[model samples]
Target: MNITKDLVPSIAYQVRTQEGVLVDEAPVNQPLEYLHGHNNLVEGLEKALEGKAVGDVFEVRVKPEEGYGEYNDNMVQRVPKDVFMGVDELEVVCVLLRTRI
Candidate 1:
């Protein structure tokens, strides 16, 4: 059956970087299942899966804009380390902590 709006799809996918490095994947034994065409998947991936049937295997290249939107240099800013006072064991690269200024 072809994937369409409101239809749930079970798929096994391997996400790779442009350099062909493995990034993430849904195990074959545990395919990812989600409601199609409901913003449950990335816009590019959803578009690629459209009209695809079960057992259909294909490669999809999702541009940054279509997946997570283009990275903006202006969005990044330098903050003083003192801002994180009283917090121990801070990692070099940590999860983003967003707040409105």
Candidate 2:
């Protein structure tokens, strides 16, 4: 059966930074089956393929504002070293905080 827009599974796609580096790849090689037009995929990519078919190689480049929100320092926080009473491996960034938790 030829894959159409509606009947096709939620297509799986890969994303990579434009800097000649592999940023991310799909978890699986098989296409993921999901209903479309339901915020199933990223807005930019989905919008580009509003009426596309399977085996069609399309490209959608989304900026930080669209693809994923800008990196916020708030995502990361620093706590006192003593707070970790008994944690063997507490890692922040690349630093290894060896404490007993």
Candidate 3:
């Protein structure tokens, strides 16, 4: 079925920076699923995926504004490596989730 609003679509994707740095990816055997038209994905990606069908393969370039908003220098903060000492692993783009009970 064609992808459309309110439908759940499963996709294997790779995200890269304009400089060709690999940022993120999902393997075909384990695709990412999201609810369409519900702001579940970046704006440009959602637009590009609209109307696509299963097994379709394509590359989309999403600009800063469309993807994660423009980078701001003021938001940058220098943190000492020692701050993360004792952590089992530290990697770029690692997400830490905190749940409130």
Candidate 4:
């Protein structure tokens, strides 16, 4: 059966960076299953997989805009280390304190 909206799809995928660095992967024996057209998968990926059938192997390049709505440079900032006092492992604490712009 072809993949369509409202239908569940099991896909074996390998995600890589533009530079070819391996980011994530799903084995063929253990495909990632998700509901189609339900925002369960990335927008670009779901759109690319639409109408595809079983055993179909293809590649898709999802731009930042389609994948994560683009990166906002204004959302990033540098903070002082002193702000994280009492945290023994600073690297393990990946918290972003939001502030009103």
Top model number, TM-score:
3
Question: Tens-digit lDDT track for model 4 on 25-96?
Answer: 777777778889999866777788889888786778776666776667788787888888887665422211
Instruction: Give the Å shift of residue 11 in candidate 2.
Output: 2.3
Local distance difference test scores for all models: 0.69, 0.52, 0.72, 0.69
Instruction: In angstroms, give how far residue 63 of model 2 lies from its true place.
Output: 2.5
Over the stretch 2-101, how does candidate 3's per-residue lDDT look in tens digits? 8899999888876665556666777777878889999998787888888888877777767667777677878879898889888877666621111110
In TM-score terms, candidate 2 sits at 0.54
Q: Please state every model's RMSD to the true fold in angstroms.
A: 8.6, 10.4, 7.3, 9.2
- In terms of lDDT, the best-performing candidate is 3
Kindly list the per-residue Cα lDDT of model 2 for residues 6-88, writing each as its tens digit. Answer: 55455655555444344444444664565556766565555665666655665666555544567788886778878988876
The collision pairs in model 3 are none
Better of 3 and 4 by TM-score: 3
Q: TM-scores of the models, in the given order?
A: 0.70, 0.54, 0.75, 0.70
User: In model 1, which runs have C-alpha deviations exceeding 4 angstroms?
Assistant: 74-101
- Of models 2 and 3, which has the larger lDDT? 3
Model 2 residue pairs with clashes: 10-34, 86-100, 86-101, 87-99, 87-100, 87-101
